[model samples]
Target: MRAEFFIKSFCRIENGQVMFNGNTIFTTESEIFSNFSKETYRHFEISYPKFFKMDNLSKLAFLAAEIILKNENLDADKNNIALVFSNRASSLDTDRKHQKSIENSGSIFPSPAVFVYTLPNICLGEISIRHRLYSENSFFIFEKFNAEHLQLYAHNLLRTKKAEKVLCGWVEFDGDDYKAFLYLVEKNAEIPHTVQKIESLYYNE
Candidate 1:
């Protein structure tokens, strides 16, 4: 059997804040980092001016992806990697906006551009396109994320040699509340295969 790279390590939204390595990143939603210092906030502002402009769902997905990328410590210089993201809301905000145009406004016929983002999986496409990842890509949504299903699909991908690495997770945005936690799982023996263990990493609160 070919050697599968281990998960190596992972990170989380520690203590309900956007924290990594014990330092808080400016996060507005959780209120955990409501006391972030001026210097820290400035750094985030400079590094991600566009981040603040994104809608809640986009922001959540982007932040989750960033956390995964940072923790993986892998080079993203190439476009061969794959990103498989599954979410519950499925661009509901985007749909709401576009639907208003179709339902309420007669003159502003809905644009196809806006319609494309309505699918639940388009968020995966957005992330992949942003990172130039063109490999195996998919987006799925169940009534809730099925841990057994996710594990089986992940294992099948690695066993079939589809992706060198995969980024998968649950990201949901409903109104002001959002929860996103992603994992970088590859073919590895050290990782846990049981659904209970994997599912525990998400939704700590």
Candidate 2:
């Protein structure tokens, strides 16, 4: 395959700073969690909506994705974009609640509202719907954060031409840490089609 795109652009979090095009965009006190709602805090360190909302992940993903898209100035609906994400705790919060409902013994009916968020993939559904990105989507879970999984899945999508572009990374919210990072990769002039070595990029030590 030929290199179709060179990274004319890049953004990253490093050295306690978010560097974009060599400029700092935003930073916050680590104590920002002090101001979140109680339920948000329980599920995600004081997030909005207080209680578990099946849509919460979508909301967060949308904001994060939109931030990247706006900074890169890419239009979501126009691009044939895909979203691939992996997380350590896939809907563990909702799973706990659903089990509680059944375990109540007396109350045999699980609330359909709470039961819905138990799936690991619904977050991706939420994001795709919000962005109107009716393209490829996937969600994976691992014991811990693994950049190798993220990179390989993304590279395979591009390699197989399942999508011309992809938005991929990690997003997990529980207790106090609501961390997310995403990159938009598109077929272009700089990067050519070849073996995408995720191990070297993520596991070089």
Candidate 3:
């Protein structure tokens, strides 16, 4: 029989609030995605100087990963954790910025800093880089959150010994709207990793 897996830790960062494992650990009144993310970073005292340079999608994903992994004592050489993240917009927010920079007739050229984040999977790289997790990782774009797909992907990774633990969820930032929901999956944890539970956690049920 395949060993069961559980959601060891989860994080939700959206609507100007940050929740860890179903508890509101930090709250901000600012509705602007940039301001809220920066404030939350400062409030949490996350020690990453490069965080300020990341695009909004990366910022949201980074914050969610930071909240859950701070207590994890992450190994610099850890290669057992896998990352599977999905988003609806596929870096449209940053793509727009890149476009604007390119279309600016007054400017000579587009900003290279902003141009680097045109791909949605770049956020996954950001999280992986920060956590030092050199494991199998993939980023998918869906019309909406596909909980069933996520459950299946994580399960396969865990069962096949590709990863001892998996970090999976949705992180999206499109224009001024943004949201993030991340969970860590492993054996012998509190909540079973299932489609129903994933939908409930995402929908706040």
Please report, in order, the local distance difference test score of every candidate based on alpha carbons.
0.60, 0.57, 0.90
Model 1 whole-model lDDT (C-alpha atoms): 0.60
lDDT of 3 by residue, 77-177 (tens): 76578999998999898888887887884564569899899899998899888888888999999999999999999999989999999999999888778
**Poorest stretch of ten by lDDT in candidate 3:** 101-110
lDDT string for model 1 (19-91, tens) is 5323455444334332222233354443555544445566556665765564455556754556666767677
- My TM-score estimates for the predictions, one after another, are 0.72, 0.65, 0.95
Q: Which prediction has more favorable TM-score, 1 or 2?
A: 1
Question: Which scores greater on TM-score, model 1 or model 3?
Answer: 3
Q: How do the residues 33-88 of candidate 2 rate in per-residue lDDT, one tens digit apiece?
A: 33322222343233334233543444445445645655544465575678887778
Q: What lDDT does model 2 reach?
A: 0.57
Top candidate, metric lDDT: 3
The candidate scoring highest on TM-score is: 3
